[model samples]
Target: MFARRALLGLAAALALSTAAPAQTQAQTQAQAQAPNPRVRIETAEGPIVLELYADKAPKTVANYLKYVDRGLFDGASFYRASKPPGYAPNDYGVIQGGLQNDPKKVLPPVAHEPTTQTGIKHVSGVISMGRHAPGTAQADWFIVIGDQDYLDADPKDPKKTPGFAAFGKVVEGMDVAQTILGKPVDPKAGTGAMKGEMLVKPVRIVRVRRVQ
Candidate 1:
């Protein structure tokens, strides 16, 4: 009957409409959830490789990747290395490095992801993105020179504003980081995070790439 044919045609049209939308949604999710691209930092001191964790902090890791894939850290020096003021050797330590004078490369601040939600910790050899303000963290990242678990989650927080979210850690060449740490920072040189003539010969990051 013509009525039956009409109903069948309507059903087919409805199915076509619904299926297309579902397929589009699946494609979008796939693009979003793909494994984070790997990044490696090669310093004149040595090469430090890191695997970014995009799943936990997609916005954060994605932000870092934007810098890495764009060659932002290359030719830049590890401008600041801070050891808790007066820590004999390597006590309270965390070394941060990134683009210094290069204005061509820089990213806008992303949301702050603390350890409480991401479950990421500031363990030794762990590399974390550094932010100027609470949510201003971006391309600049630091490597934990000591056990910095205090930077992790705070259970008391409901919003989980615990602290800086750690995305990845160093897999090799920590000695290079140590060497930079031992390079004698001046308090008045206005360089190497100091006030007057520091670094003598600044430690630089020559290149960065993705490793298997």
Candidate 2:
């Protein structure tokens, strides 16, 4: 009886010893695979959901979330619908929105997170910061309606522009975004690159909030 008990105890110990490393490894994998944070933008046209790449662009994501948490983006509008000059209205473009430099709501500009550093790209539905120069991004941001690889950082860029800070992508309500893109633009509303791209009736952002 004693010999049988000893054999059983040894078998249990061996099993546990072999399982310990595998269990720890599984836990580590779970932590690494944890999902990124997401937010929903409630708009007059509809809701657009985005999954922020906090892991890739920590500063940009945190800055955006600050605007969301502070309700700064509430009642803001998608004021610009930019398309290539010759392209069809809804075929390819970006829709921009934010506090629009509201003196009371706009926060301090955050450091730019270039695509080169973040490993994010300006692909379809990607959301990126709007800035005149690097590190000047405040509350304004835009969502790409289609792939805009030109927006990605290029070492060979003669202008040496660091490209936009892309932090997230639209996860839902792209149709609503498209609809806004197709809306009317005042013939002479915007300035410079945004010329003729400002939506005549800006799409109101009802609210912005985090989601699981």
Candidate 3:
């Protein structure tokens, strides 16, 4: 009877040990699948709240958060609004902001997280990184004005062009986003890729912060 009792006790101990790890794994998976982080970007027009897809674009989200934490976007301006005439063929485009390659405000580039990999699309109100080339994105980002699936990675030939990294979307203040999109652009101000796209009076970014 003593031996049988000891065996039962040992079996119970083993069962507990096994259950502990399974419980921990279940908790970890639940945390991983939790709701993504949210942030509020206060601009002169209004406050645009964005919900970032940390699970899909972890690195991109982290990089953006770093800038927000450091107050890098304060006083920044939405300097470009790429619209119909400014960016022909692509009727609906984006409102570009952040450092704008200022060198003074630019942070080091983060690794590109292509839409093909993240499974995020560049739909209206979607926020995406702006880069001269893959792996060159730093502080610059854009908010899509309308359905812009062309910004997504071409599944047929993703190797040639990975497309932009879309990390989040405007949860509120899209009307403000459209207001910025309709702002006046300088006909003779910008050069090269930015020609005719530069805003004559860029909208100011008052501040950006994380919110519950």
lDDT of each: 0.74, 0.91, 0.90
TM-score of each: 0.74, 0.83, 0.86
Candidate 3 lDDT over 1-212, as tens digits, reads 99999999999999999999999999999998799999999999999999999989999999999999999999998999888754543346799999877888777899999988999999999999999889999998999988989889998899797899999999998888888888888889898878999999999999999987
TM-score, cand. 2: 0.83
Q: Poorest 10 consecutive residues of model 3 by lDDT? A: 84-93
In model 2, where is the ten-residue run with the lowest total lDDT? 153-162
lDDT of 1 at 40: 76
- Cα miss at 50, model 3 (Å)? 0.6
Model 2 RMSD in Å is 4.6
User: What is the per-residue lDDT of model 1 for residues 51-107, given as tens digits with 9 covering 90 to 100?
Assistant: 777777777887787777788777877877676667754445777787653457777
Index of the highest-TM-score prediction = 3
For model 1, give the RMSD to the true fold: 4.4
- List runs of model 3 lying over 4 Å from the truth: 1-19, 86-91
Compose the digit string of candidate 2's lDDT tens values, residues 123-155.
Answer: 989999999889999999999988998898885
Once fitted onto the true fold, the runs of candidate 1 whose alpha carbons sit more than 4 angstroms away are: 1-36, 85-92, 158-162, 189-200
lDDT, model 1, position 129: 75
Candidate 1 Cα deviation (angstroms), residue 16: 13
